[model samples]
Every structure is written in C-alpha cells, then in structure tokens.
Target: MNNQNVFYDELCLSIYTTNRYFHQLYQIVLGKYELTYLQYMVLLNIKQQGKSTLVVICRNLDLDTNTLTPVVKKLMIKNWIKREKSVTDGRSFELFLTNSAEQKFELIQIEIARIQEKLVGDDQQQFTKILSQTHTLNNRVQELIDELTNKK
Candidate 1:
C-alpha cells in the first residue's frame, strides 16, 4: 500500500482508540455520580442552556426523544434535575438544575477540566489548532451522516 493509505489506516485506528479511551475515562469520572457519559452530557447541555425543553436537548445532543427521555427521567429521579411546566406551553416541560445538582456540578466541572487538560497537553497554540480542526471534523461527520441517513 502507498504511504498515504498507510497513514490513513493509522489515523482511523488512532481516532477509534482515542474515542474509546475518552469514553472509558468519562465513565470512570461519572460513575461517582451514578451517571453514564451520555447522561452527563445531557446534564451539561441542560446546564449550558440554563433551562431547556426535551426537544431542544434532543436536538443539541443529536438524539431522538425516545433515546433522551429515559436519561432525563433518570436524572429527575436522582434529584439532580427537575422538570417544570413551560410558561409558554403548558403541555411541554422544561428542564432545570436542582440545588443538589448545582453543588455536585462544581466538583464535577473541576474534575472534568483536569481530565481535559491532561488529555490535551498544555500547549495553547496546539489546543487552538485542535479546536479548529475538531469543528471542521464535526461538520464533515454531520454532513456524511445526513447524506447516509437521507439515502436510507
């Protein structure tokens, strides 16, 4: 095989392995709070939005309602989050962080930041470049997913 093809193969493996490692690390970190990685992501999405609806969380997380609902329900049951009737739409509910969640979040955020710094070395310029590339990579991946799904 050509050098380019060899490099491509290596790159694909590296990406896959890195994703697996990251997922494992996230799970370990989140286990203390009894959360899965996806659940933590849902919490972050809700926290970032301040108050969000199920539809909005689903869209942000690239998940469907069926997939997201159970995670949301679990968080609610844990008393980490709560759902309130939407002011504009009584039929729909909005999600918010409970005070208990807020207390836990301070430590969670700190630990996550520590892990991020460890995974991503402390090179400012390199981190900036990686962030830029990641945005492009995400867009391309989304485009491919859309193309494939539309064909189905």
Candidate 2:
C-alpha cells in the first residue's frame, strides 16, 4: 500500500478504537445511573443549553429527530427530563432537566471528571495537544463532507 493509504487506514482505526474505548468507559460509569452514553450526551446538551427545543438539540448534537425522539421520551419517562410545548413554536417541544436530574447531575459530572482525569493523568500538555489535533481533524472531515455533498 501507498504511504497515503496506510496513513488513512491507521487514522481510521485509531479513531474507531478510541471511540469504542470512550464508549465503554462511559457505559461503565453511566450504567450505574441507568443512562447510556447517548442519553448522557442528550442530558449534557440540555444542561449546557438550560432549555432547548428538539430542533435545536438535534442540530446541536448532529442527530436527526427520529434518533433523538425515543431518547428524549426515555429521559422523560426516567424523570430526568421534562418536555413541554414551545410557546414560540407550537409544532415543536422544549426540553428541560427535571429537579431529580438536576440533583443527580453533579454526581454524574464527578464520574465524568474521574474518567477524564484518568485519560489525562499527569500529562496536561499531551491531553491539550490531542484535543487540538482532534478538533482540526474534525474540521477537515466536515469540509470533506461538504465538498462531497455539494458534488451530489
């Protein structure tokens, strides 16, 4: 194989492997609360946004409504989140963390921090370097996606 193809394959493998590692770590930690990694992602987004519409959440998370709808419903059923009709947009609903979710958020955050600390152990510089490189790589991927999409 050519050098370029080898590099591309290695990059793909690294990304896939790292993603799985993170997912497993999240599952181990979040399973205690009966939350999956995706569920935690939704809750984190809602926590960051305070209150958000399904459309906004979908856009922010790069998820389609169909994929997120069940998760949102599950969160509601689990009493971690509550959904209400939007006053501005009657067609959509807004989501907010419930009091119970708020109470547990800190505990969840602590576990997340522990996971991150393990990954970043004794090497802040290395962690920052990887974080920056990942963001750059992600931007390039998006640009490539846009270019290919426009060609269609």
User: When superposed on Cα atoms, how far off is each prediction in RMSD?
Assistant: 2.3, 1.8
Could you give candidate 2's per-residue lDDT for residues 1-152 as a string of tens digits? 89999999999999999999989988987999999988999999999999988888889889999999999999999999998888998887889999989989879999889988888889999889999999999989988998989942
**Among all windows of ten consecutive residues in candidate 2, which has the lowest summed lDDT?**
143-152
The clash count of every prediction, one per candidate, is: 0, 0
Cα lDDT for residue 74, candidate 1: 93
Deviation from native of the Cα of residue 89 in model 2, angstroms: 4.0
Q: Best TM-score goes to which candidate?
A: 2
Cα lDDT tens digits for candidate 1, 51-143: 999899999888999999999999999998999999999999999999989889878999998988887766878989978987898888888
Best by lDDT: 2
Clashing pairs in 2: none
In model 2, how large is the Cα lDDT of residue 80?
A: 96
Could you tell me every candidate's TM-score relative to the true structure? Answer: 0.85, 0.90
